[model samples]
Each structure stands twice: as structure tokens, then as C-alpha cells.
Target chain A: MQQTKQRLLTGNKALAEAIRLEMERDPNVFVMGEDVGVYGGIFGATEGLFQKFGPERVIDTPISETAFIGAAIGAAAEGMRPIVELMFVDFFGVCMDQIYNHMAKIPYMSGGRVKLPMVLMTAVGGGYSDAAQHSQTLYATFAHLPGMKVVAPSTPYDLKGMMISAIRDDNPVVFMFHKTLQGLGWMDQLDASIGHVPEEAYTVPLGKANIVREGTDITIVGIQMTVHQALEAAKRLEQQGIQAEVIDLRSLVPLDKETIIQSVKKTHRLLVVDEDYLSYGMTAEIAAIAAEHCLYDLEAPVKRIAVPDVPIPYSRPLEQFVLPNADKIFREAIQLVNE
Target chain B: MAISKDHLLWMYETMYKIRCYEDKMAEAYAEGKSPVFNIGAGPVPGEMHLATGQEPAAAGMCVHLKKEDTVTAPHRPHHHAIAKGVDLNRMTAEIFGKATGLGKGKGGHMHLFDPDVKFSCGGIVGAGIPHALGAALAAKKRGTDWVAVAFIGEGAANQGAFHESLNMAALWKLPLIVVIENNQYGISVPKTASTAVPSNDVRAAAYGIKGYYVKDNDPIDMYNVSKEAVERARTGQGPSIIEIETYRYLGHFQGDPEVYRDKNEVTLLRQKDPIIRLRNYLLNECGVTEETIAQLENKATFEVDQAYAFARESDYPKPEEALEDVFV
Candidate 1:
């Protein structure tokens, strides 16, 4: 693969660039959402495309999530690749039928005869205290459902590359981006979110995990913003003579279990950090994987940190207490290593 | 139907209370959120959807309802909750995440549930339409005159639930009234860009139901139109749709940049403020005394102030309380 000149880009701009390049490359590709047009996007995922492609290509639908999301699946079935944004991932309740029942099942329900090639991109994760409805990173909820390819990118480079790859893929892909990583002026952003994204389009295939850090004592697995939190925790753990390896599980549905298994095998300990709920979520899934594959290799029971099975609270104090942060991760990592 | 003196007083008092509460809420929402407006920084953290300019829709329609009737409101729900007679202290405490809240701090401002007054609201755009329909169905089944009202924004009228619920209500002849508070915008997207028809009342025809449109933001107009609709529902005719051209004085959420709308738009809308119009009508047409008007204003201020004080002094729920209420 030929690499192009790299420039500093936020996670949102990288995503927008990927969509722009894909739309330019393929005439069948288009974008639609609540505020995707004129307002760019509430999270800036579809910025500048509305002006470049106009309303026809970058359409703005009503607050009818079921209608628009279902329309995306229908449009995809007819050969047009629609990259529809559902604004917030929390709003999936109204349109989950169209997603799980239709969008996910169409390809298999038709026995591969009808290919519903589309991307359902939405803003996920909760940190700035937008309350329960506005703030949620429902990764496991979507991943638990089969048929959709769920990918949540942490940095600009991976977001750009994975977005391009998701567009070119033949299956329905769920692209989840965190609001804090979008690098918008209003919200406080993480330093790790801004990275060198290649000017030209590239493909980072889905279902592959990136080993962001290497260690020997334990493996810390995370996705989206949790990956950054895991890395921060790993850095703090290094001072205490504990070397923790970090794995960014970019894809959830087609999970990179091999990478996780190999890393856990070498380390003999594992800690899964997730922003989603603790019960029946990504942590449980990863813990089950380790228990199934390397039951003997695990020196201690698989420790996991996540939102404590509760709706994202609105008040700052309560919200901070429930959210999975670096301090919580570090404390949990220490406990895992000691155990 | 003629607007009686008592009805006029009730409308004015309700609208005044809503305005006062919203004004105080806006001030409280701005606390700890200055210089840089971090949404989570304030004492009242999270999104605050203030019903600043859309009080008439609630006052006019709710003035006709009883305690047994159910009212389901949208995200911007303070006006409807107040008009529907939800306890101000508990509702305010809920917004402040206090244990004394309606849902014991578990449900925030958008998810206010007060079974006492049979009032509840949801954060989702059109999610409440079906809930109102179900309530209306139960009322019809129980052989009662209890009606259900769902107050939704113009943008929500385009939702699938809105259409589905309307069709079901019309088919079953349920006692439901759908009020479309056409406040022009759903966040940044204007109603013109979102809805297929100019007014949502026209969509009511598709369900074979009577539809009424309120062009002005006048409470009298809203009240007169709602009277017929309410009568039709209570008499077991069917459901009705009322699309009121209201106003949203503030941004979609507090601290919104609002680049999509013109800066002067809110100012222009405020010139013909519904509260002021209603007050003038009461004083001039109804020959109400200025002292009586002053008394109502003082009462509204006093009640709103008490509610705010109660909310501030109340303790937040124990952190462990979040684990509860997921089930029974």
C-alpha cells in the first residue's frame, strides 16, 4: 500500500474526509441524518459534505429514526450504498427493529441474493454529562446482535481508514464514534484523538485488532475511548513495575479473538475495560473468551472495569463515579496484577 | 364558545407560572456554566430544554383537562408538566437529580414520571405518541370519559410512531388528542425542511380524523380550537390533531451555538409574546383588575421560587440508588 502525506486531523474530520472521498469515488454512495445537512452533524461526522454534495447527496431527514434508518436499508438493497447517521446511539430504541430485524437480517434472510451494503454511523460514549438519553456508548447492545459489523475507532488514523473500508465492504457496518474524540470546539477533547491521517484514502480492514502497547505481566483490552483510558492506565502501571499490554479491539461483532487469546496467553492475566455496562457487555464477552480459550493460562480470575450496570447519570458527581476512567482502570489493573 | 372570565384567569395564571418557572430555571441552568459553557459543569448538569416561549399551547389545552386525564409530553416538557398539575417541587427536584424527585433522582428532566397527576414524559422525539394512545385505549376500555393528550414538537410529527399511533387511534376510536407544538425547529432543522406538508394538521386527514391548525400563537385561538377537539374525544367520536404555530425563544439546548438559525429570529417572535397577549386580553377584554393580575404574578413567582429552593436544598440520591429502579 502506498502511503500519502500525513497531516494532523481530528477523529471527526478524518471520518468526514473518508465519506467525502468515498462519495467522490462511488456515485452510489450518499449520506443522510437529522442534522447531517447544513449543521454538518451535531458531532461533526458529516461536516462539509452537505456543502460539497448539496442536499441531494447529503440529505437531512426528519427526527423519524425508524423511517430514515429503514429507508437506508431499503436503499442499500437496491444497490445504492447509504451511510446513514442516527445522531446519537441512545436514540436506537425507536429504530432497533429496522436495524436488528431488517438491516442485520436482510442479507442472510435472502440467502446472500440481496446484499444490503450500508453503514449505520452514530455518536457513542458518555463523559460530558448529557444525561442518560443523550449520553451512552451502547457497544455491546449492537454487538450482541448478529449480522452487523460493529467498529468503533479511537484515533483519527484508524477512523479514516476504517470508515473507508466500511464503505467499500459488502456487509452492513455499524460505525460508532465517541463525542469527546470528535475534537469539536465545545466539548473537551483527548490529546490522543488527534493523529496523523493520510490525505489520500486508505483501508484498515475490519475484524483486526491493533496492539497499541506491549507488556508481559497482563493484557488490557478496550475499544473506542476506553482504549485511550487503558493506555493511560498502562503508562501509570509501568511506574509500579507492572507492564500491561493494551489491545484496541476496533471491531466488535467480528471480534479479533485470536489477538486477544495470544496476548492473554503470553501475559497470563487480563483486564477488560469498557465504557458500556458491566453485566452482559463487552467485558463479559472478553472474559468468556479468555475463560474458554486460556482457562489454565489465566493466573487470576479475569478482572473487568466498566459502567456499573446503570444508566448514565446526569449530575456530574454521580456521572463521574459511574464512568470508567483512567484512575479506575489503574486501580483495577493494580488489583489484577496483585491478585 | 365564549372565553369565560374564570378560564381566562386560569390560562393567564398557568402561562405565568410556566414562564416564571422557565425563567428561574434558565438562570439556575447558567450557574457554574460561564466563560466556557460546559454542559456538565453547572449545579444542574445535563441538557436543559427550556419551554420559554411555548407556554400558550400547554395553558390553553390543559385548562380544559381534569386530574384523571393523562398528558404525555416531549423533551421540552416543563410547560406541559406545570399545566398538567405535576408537583413543582418534585419535578424541579427531579431536574436537579435530588432524591425527592418524582423518580427518586433516577429519571432526570426529560424522564419525568408523576403517576399522581397521570403525567409522564420521554426524551425521545415522538416516543410519547404511542404511550398516549395506550392510555386513551385503556380509558375507552374502562368505559370512562378520560382522554389522553400527547404534546409533541413539529419535528416529531414526522416520526413513524406519530403516524402509527394516529392510525390506531382512528381505527379503534380512542379518546386521544395529539397536539403538535410547531415551534418551527427540531434542534437546528426547521419544520419546513423536515415535514412534507406546511402544517402537520393536514396529515391528520390521512387517518380520517378531524384536524385543527392554530396560525397565531394566541391562547384564545388555541383554547377555542381545543374545545371542539376535546368535546369530540369525550363524546366518543375519535381522536383529533391540533397543530399550534408556537415559538421557541431559546436555543435547542442550553449552550447551543445556534448557527443554523438567524440571531434576530427569537427577538422577532418575542414581540408578539403569547403571555403578554393573554395578559392584555384579560385586562382589556375581560375587564380584569390590575391588582388581580399583580396577585397572580406574585403567586407564580412565589411558587416557582419555593420549588427552586426546595430543589437546591434537597439531597441527591445515594450513588448506590442508580442500581435500583431498573426493575420493580
Candidate 2:
């Protein structure tokens, strides 16, 4: 058996390490965004990249999202794989046209003549009362739009591997990493945030789901930080008679429906947990999938535990009320398994 | 500076070709327009934003550009595409939504893209400004002298992307040229109502870049300014903004009632048409024969006819082809 060599890393550091590896591998790769150079990124996804790559490759752009993002599109069209940061997923409103129209549609519009091998990385999720503007996990919004791949990594291992894959992918990829999962020293950390990542380069593949925990009673689906919540909830459910199966949907765009369907077939009960809002989101989509394909196999109504259609409030209690947590996922999974 | 006869002849031919091509496009669009707006109802459907009288700006600016140089234009980009030496047959077929088009029928006229000549345009106003800067950045990073030109109207100068692009280009000293075709209208709203400044070139001062305003829509004057700007960019002197005062002979789109502009203004602008002025300059000043000018016009007309026929005869893309380009 091959010994698993691992080094502990935060999600941000893992992403930066992946970027460093890709930058070392290809001369055409570069990073650009607001405060990405001197400030080392608002979330440190680009920490230490400036010193390694210099200012030529690590560009500090103005707060003009439309201009710099569109510039990334143009640069990508010209054969440079630009990794641009949007700071926060909530800030996509300022430059949605560049994201949806130019960056996303350019390849399709060019009829495959031009390839936009670029990564649009941004921090997502809310945990520490960043208010409504700063704390949105909007993976669903990008996933809803065509012509772009959307991925959210929960573990340090997945972050490093998927960041590499996203940068190397020929199409545009939106890599949304949850802020709470970054394991930054300044922010409160989750046990699931820091993990053993391999030193060598690898890709986890874009559209495959990882069965982090196996059980037969019920199936639990989650992404990003919510995946960690589902795992914790699954552990708690294991103390009871219910054995919950946890599936982490790493990539939302090229979704691993086969894995989801297979898990649903075995478990016969489904519960989806998402940090994003409830309506028209990942949870609803998963429920729709179960309803469409494995309706006969389902023993109970599909349950969803997501943000209850409210903007993340500034108050801690109000914010906690709207967010999906392990307690909420556990309660919902218990009802799903028993019902 | 004295202009060479060959360059003058090339400029005239390019301008004439743009004029012929746009005129034919307008006629075809008019023929295709039905009472009800159905996207697939016409031979050339969708919004046809014709650059009827803005040919000189495209010809003057693009004549100084090489195939390796990149260009990004607004929705009204047929003139720029033709001026940049994009395949006319493919471009027209793209407008006709054919499988053999430049974009394989995925992008209609407003969203034409041709990587061969490094030309692209988007529907949103001022979106191309930053894209041009990006292309310029690519060239600079690759250690090449190839520059990029972004064309926008005076109306789009108010957009944040325009200001940001200008500032970044100047800051990075990227080889970029921004040409503002001040046709005095942004869709239906006149420039007077939309922009606070009378001259769009004056706005470039905020970015600490050189700005020029050409009073007349004369092709020779435009060519002179563009040559200097293009040379400055190629030699690494950084970016410049040039605003050309011109007029569009037709409505914003083919079916526009044009309630915004005074009727006399259109008539007066038509009297100072750049194509006619260029032809007269070639005849009276450059010592070119009338027969040569006639031959160029005839050739342009012939090419437009051939492009139209090719587009008309081309096949529509298969329905399954839409899924092909979405990823790769």
C-alpha cells in the first residue's frame, strides 16, 4: 500500500499553493484582482503569490470590476490563463455583465475558435456577521448561468486539487471558496477546514461527487461549508438508529447526477443542506432531481435545510437563524429518516 | 505630412467597401422586417445597428493596424469588422445565422467575433473598452509591439468601463488606442442630453493621456490622427483617445422612427459625406484618375453582392451544434 503523505493546510493556503504550482508550470498563468498584489488578497487566496511571481504576473487592479474582469476576458481570449478574484461573491453585482456576458459567453460566442482558460475565484458564505452585502454564497447564481463551470471546495485537499483543475480547464470556471472554511487565524475555524493535502499536484476532477461518509438509512447532499455541516450531522445521526450517507457535490455545473441517483436509490431518503437561500437554489435543484428520477425509491418527502430566504442579518442570532448549521441539518435529517 | 497615393487609394477603397456593405445590410434588413418581431422570420434577423455614415472612422483607424493587432467595437461593428480585414463572407454569413459564419451562427451580428483577425464586439455599450485594454496587456506581457484599438461612441464615454480602461491603460503604459465616434446620439438620446462635456476627447485629460478632437469627418484628417496614435502605441508611448465628429446617415436601427434628431441636421450632414470627400480628394489633390475611383467603387459593390449571395445560400446551423461550443 502507498503511504499517504500529507501536510496540514487552510483552504486559502491550499488555493494559493495550487496557484503557485500552476504559475510554476506555465509562464502564461497570472493573477489579477483588487488588492491581490500588495494586500495579498482580501481573503489570502493569493498570499505570497506577489513575491513569487512579481508584479508583472500578480496584478493589482482598481475597484472597477467591469474593466478588470472584462480585461481578464480579453486576456484569456488572447491565450493567457488569468486567475481573477472578485473579492466576494456578493460583489458580482457590480460586474455581472463581464461575468455573464463577456467572460462566460465569449467562448460559445466565438464558436470554440477562442478558448478562455481562466479562473474567477471569489470568497463565499457567511459565519461571522459580515452583513448582507459581504456574506453570500452565490454558487447557484453562476450555476444557473450557462457557459461557465462552478465549483466549491470544502476541504483543503479538494481546494488545492480543484483550483489546479479550474486553472487548467479550457473553459471559464468560477471557484467559490467559503470564507468560514478558509481557517484563517483571524476568523474562527472549523475542524473540517484544515485537512491533510498532498505535496504533489493532483486534480479531484470537476463533476464527481465524493461520498465522504457512507450510510444506508438516508442520503445527505451539501456543498462548500454545508458539506462539513452535513458530515457533522451525519455523525450525530449515527448515534441514533439512522445511518446517514453524506455526498459532497464538489462541482455544481457538471454535476455528478449519477452518484446522487445511486445514493438516493440506496438510502431511499434525501436531505439537502445549502448555505445559499432556499428558493431556486441548490437544495431545490437536488429535490427536483430526486423527484424526477428516483421518485419511486423515495420513502419520504425530500427535505431541504437552507437559508430561509432572508438576507444575512448583522445580528448574530438573526444570522444564525437564517444559516444552515449541523443542528438544523441533524433535525431535518432525523425527521426525513423517521418520516 | 504628405500622404502617399497608394495609402490614399487603399483608404478610399476601404471606406467605399464599408459604405457598400452597410448599405446592402440596411436594404436586406428592411426587406426582412415584418409587422411582428420574430427572430427567425427574416433572412437577416435581430437588431441591425448599421454604421451607415461612420465608415471613415473605421477605415482611417484600421488602415494603420496589422492582422496581429486586436480590435473591440460596440454593437455597431460591421464597419470595424470589414475595416480590420475580417472575412466578409463569414461575417455576412454570421449576420445571416449560418453554420459557416465566423461565430458558427452562435453569435449574431451584434456579437460577432473573429479570432483570425483578433476582432470581437459585444452588445452592451462600453463593454469593449476594457477588453481592448486586456488584449493590449497580453501583447505587452508577451513582449510584442502589437497594439489594440477599442472603438466606442461619444455616448459610451460616460460609462465607468471607459474611464477605468483609460486610467489602467495609461497607468500600465499599455499600447491601446480609444477612438470615439461622436455621431451625436446614443440610441435615441442625443449627446447633449447624455454627456455633460461637449467634447469627449477633453475627458481623457482626467487620465493624463493625450486626447485629440477632429472637427471635420474628413477621411484624410482621421487617417493622419490615427497614424500618429497607432505609431505612438507601437513605439510604447502609451495610449491616446481620439474623438471624431461624424454623423450616421440612417436611424439608430433600420426601423427607428428617429424622433430625436432634427431633419435638417441629417440632410446637412449627408452633404459633407466622408466617402464623397475622399473621392474628391483622390481626384483633385492626390492626382488619381476618375476611372480608378470608379473601378474601386465597382469592386466594392461586387464584393458586397458576393457576400450577400454567399450568406443567403449558406445553411443554418444544426440544432445540436449549440451544445458543442458551450464548453471547449
Candidate 3:
């Protein structure tokens, strides 16, 4: 199955399609979350799921994330493949105990005897008028937990593949699909640039980063939409006669350190671009690992292009000014190469 | 109808073990040998809800269950664990937070585990009920005669998990025994504070399941009432809500200031303590000899002591193992 043959779909729409396919294929698979069934998700990732799967499976639970997640954990323990939508990435704090403490740890706590196999889908990022409470890339928190996997697929295809893989995995998975990049508009660009991805329930086997374009000057590591920005940054840097390697780390956890390290070693410079704040988080973790293994490989100290430490202000200029765009990434890549 | 001598004996044994162990735990907690628990962390004043007054309900109801059958309970689960055949040594070790403990020192005393003995302990209040529902669903799927029991206190019965579990179990016709022990209190607030329906059984009509209420203090009566529930579940007739009307012999926890209740209330409840009632009945009516009773206590004490030793001697988990079991 070629990638372009896939019809128009957003990351959220692709998720909705996969939810339908998963429920269709497995009698035991059920999708549950707030408004997922009737109103679709708050972001509409589960649109039409209820009509297709019925209320029994596409349950609209009360605003009790902890209770529902815990119930889903129990149900998964009882052999149901439940894909739970958490509405937004930031609200994980409300049910973090169930996620990190209970669902993430049940399998190991049971002496390698239990498999949680629950998929948690949530919308992450700043934009679309959703305030600070709703907008933030907190995948790092889940990535740090043991016995859990965090996948933030930036496109429709990877979104489908990663969600399928997450559903099939025996351990718990938190799939953080970004608000800005979910949909089919990126398909043509991704197809033209990255080219030919295998279609099927094929797992891209987690912990691997894709080099959107190979370069020998600087390695630019990007996450989610930041990867797209990095690709544009690479194009601009190419115009500057400075070739930049673009690495999209699809999954934050089980990080594809080797790919990033090798890219940095070849490029001899490193720059990371993430939509998250330039704080003690995923970028910090990646920078630490790069410093530990491939610091000398870098001709310059690694630079991180991120949102300044501030709330994602709801105003247009404030939001645009704070977000890490291609220009910021391009400037950083140029600086790393120049240094 | 009165329960058989074996039933009474089982109740006494479990009650005694729970009381003795909890008493020891309280002493340990006071001595700072246990984990640091603030005021509201556990059913306090009492280190554990020894449930000294509620033995008959646990022992009598679970006496008929087979080893393969399962039970999911909350922090107040010492009685259920014992009744389900969890090894006292491992149970004690779990309470002691030893790696040899069921949860490998992760779950602490609040988290108990013994799938071999068919009992799982939940640290959260109502969290265990859904697992019990799942367990019953598993039993139903496996097409086994085994049934799962959700042992909850009055407090736990008010949790959303309990509500969702009951609704789901009834909706699916799962073979589950929802044993809601109404011991008059959910940690200070009386049962009246939480529910208008004093008996959980009335809620069964809402779901179309059969319901029963037991004089929870009488092990024999509890056994008799629970017999129908067990039989109903075992026969694939689906679940039933059975509320046992019992009393806690101690405060909601040990060392409770107990300012809420009068000395007379405690004295009156103690006068009809289930253990004493069962023990006296067994001796006077069932002709269980004092020698046999003494032997049982001795054995229980020895076993509790052995569990303590195992917990004390078991290695603490290597710090790395903390992250190891997060995924299995």
C-alpha cells in the first residue's frame, strides 16, 4: 500500500478512521472518552465512532478521567483493547495517578504477568484559541514513566501506524497528536519529500527517527510540527549553501538516539527544534543525551529552538511570536554551522 | 438458619488473624517501623481497619469459595485476604513492604497481592471494584465455574468505580458477588451521610439483579445469606448485591480518638462481637472443644509471626527495580 493512495485525512481524522478500523477488526476493541462518540472528541479525533461502534463501545463517560481511565485499565486487564482519549495533553495531571501509577505499572507489578495494552489519545499544542490549560506539549512527562511508550506522530500515516502499533502493544501507550499538524494537508508535502511509506498495520517499530532529508552540515532534530519546521529550515539553509540534516523523532520515549547521534556525527553540528517550552523537558533530555554521546561531534554547542518560557498567550501576535517557526529553526541551524 | 461449626471456626480464625495483625501493625506504626502515613492516608487512629467486629461476614461468605475463584478488595482487606487463602507470611511481608511481598515492596501494606490465593489488594478506595468486575468477566469468558467477589466497605460503595462496576456487571450478566459490608461508617461519616438507601440491595432493583441484606454481625447469618449469592453467581445466573449489616469492634481505625461514638456504643457492640458470638456458639452449641480453638489461635499467631519474619528478612527491592516493573 503506497502512502498517497491513502485518501485525504488529518492526524485527528486519521485517528478517527483507525478507531473505526480497529473496532471493526477486533471484536474486543472499544473507544471511550469525553464526547468522542457523540460530538467526536473535543478535537474530533473520535468523530462518528459512536454511530459506527454504538454507545456500548464508544462510551461517553462522565468528566471522571481518573475513574474512566482506571476502569479502562481494569477492562484492558480483563482482555479488552480500549483506546481512551484524554481530550487534551495537559489535563493528564487530573489522571496522572491512573496513567503513571496504575496503568503504566500494573504489568510489571504483577510480576511480568499482566499486560495493560491500553491506548491513550490526547490533543497537544498551542493554537486554535485553546488556553494555557489546553495548549502544551507534555509528552515528556509520560516519556519519563517506566513501562510506558509515548508516540507523537506528526502526519496522518504515522498517526495511523503509531496508533495501530499502540493498540497492538501489550504495554500502555500515550499517543500525543498535535493540534497544529493533524490532517491530510501535509500528505502531499510529506509524500513529495519523505517519499513512499509502506501502508498496512505496519509498525514503524518505535524509537526510530526519520531523516526527512540527508545533509552533511548540521543535524536539526525536530518533534511533531517542529520536524516540519526543521524541514523548511533545511530547505532555507540549503539555499545558504549550508546543508542541514532533518531528523523527526516521532516517539519521544525509547528515543532513537542512534539515528540522532549518527546524524550529528556526520553533520558535525546539532540543533533541536520542539514546540515545547525551552525548559527542563524533552529538549533538555535530548540535549543531555547528545552532549553525553556526541558532544565532540558537534562543531558548536547544540542549540534548541523552542517557545520562550511563558504561557501560550491566546492573542494572535503573542501565540505566533512564542511558537517555534521555520525561520527560528533556520537561524539556529545557520548559527550552529557558522560556529 | 445457623451456619455449620466449620463456618463459625473459619470466621473466628480470619477475624482473629486480622485483629492480631492489625494490632501489631498499629504498634509498628507507632514505633515508626512502618511507612509515614499522615492523618487521612489510611483508616486512621487505627493503623489498619482491623475489622475486629466484622469477622463473621468475611469468613462465612468466603468459606464456600474455591481457590481459583477471585476477590478484589481495598485497604480494609485483611479479612478477605485471609479468607481467600493468601499466605499470612506473604500478606505480612507485603504489609512490611518487603520485596518478598506480593507487590515486591512497591504496593506497601496498602497494596496486597496474591493471585495464587485469588485475592488482590487495592490501595485506592473504590479502585478494586472494577478489577473484580473484570475478573468476573474473565471468569465468564473462560466459561469457568469460578466467580469473582468485590469486597467493599460502606465508604467504597460510594465510589464511582463501584457504581460503574455494578452497572457494567449487571449489564453484562457477569458472575460477580458484590459484597458491600455496611459497618455503619466510612471513616467517621455514618452510612446515613452517604446514601439514602441504607441497604445496597435496594439498588439491585435499579439494575434488575436479585439483592439481599444480611445481619452482618452473625457469621452464620452472613454465610446463609451469602450462600444464595455464591450459588447464583456460580450457576451463571449473574451477579447479586448483598449488603452485610455488621459493626466494627474498634474505631474506624485503631487508636481512633473515637470522640464521635460513646463508650456505651462500643461496649454494646463489643458485647455482641462476632468473634465472641461465633466462638461461644461453636463451643456451647456446636461442641467445638476449647483445645481445638486454642490450637487454631496458636497456629494463627505462629503463622502471623512467620509472615512478619519473612517480611523482615526479605530483601528490600533494589532501587532500579522501581522503574523495572512499570511495564512488565
TM-score of chain A, every prediction, order shown: 0.98, 0.98, 0.92
Kindly report which residue stretches of model 1 are placed more than 4 angstroms away from their true locations once superposed: A1-339
Model 1 per-residue lDDT tens digits across residues B1-328:
7777898898899999999999899999999999888889887899999999999899999998999888888889999999999999999998988888887776678877776787767677776776677567557655789898999999988888788678777876889899999989889998888888999899888999999999878899999998889999999999999999999999888888899988998899999999999889888999999999999999988999999999999998898866553211
Clashing residue pairs in all predictions, respectively, total: 0, 0, 12
lDDT of 3 by residue, B198-267 (tens): 6788988877898888864777777887888899999988989888888876777655778877778878
Which candidate tops TM-score? 2
**Candidate 1 TM-score over all chains jointly:** 0.54
How would you class the docking of model 1?
incorrect
What's the residue-level lDDT of A326 in candidate 2?
A: 93
Fnat for model 3 comes to 0.31
Q: Choose 1 or 2, whichever is better by lDDT.
A: 2
Highest DockQ scorer: 2
Model 1 reaches an interface RMSD of 16.5
Candidate 2 is graded, for docking, as high
Full-model lDDT for every candidate = 0.87, 0.91, 0.76
Query: How do the residues B22-140 of candidate 2 rate in per-residue lDDT, one tens digit apiece?
Result: 88887787674567655446788878888988988999999899999999999999999999999999999999999989889999998889999999999999999989999999999
| Candidate 1 local Cα displacement, residue B263, angstroms | 2.8
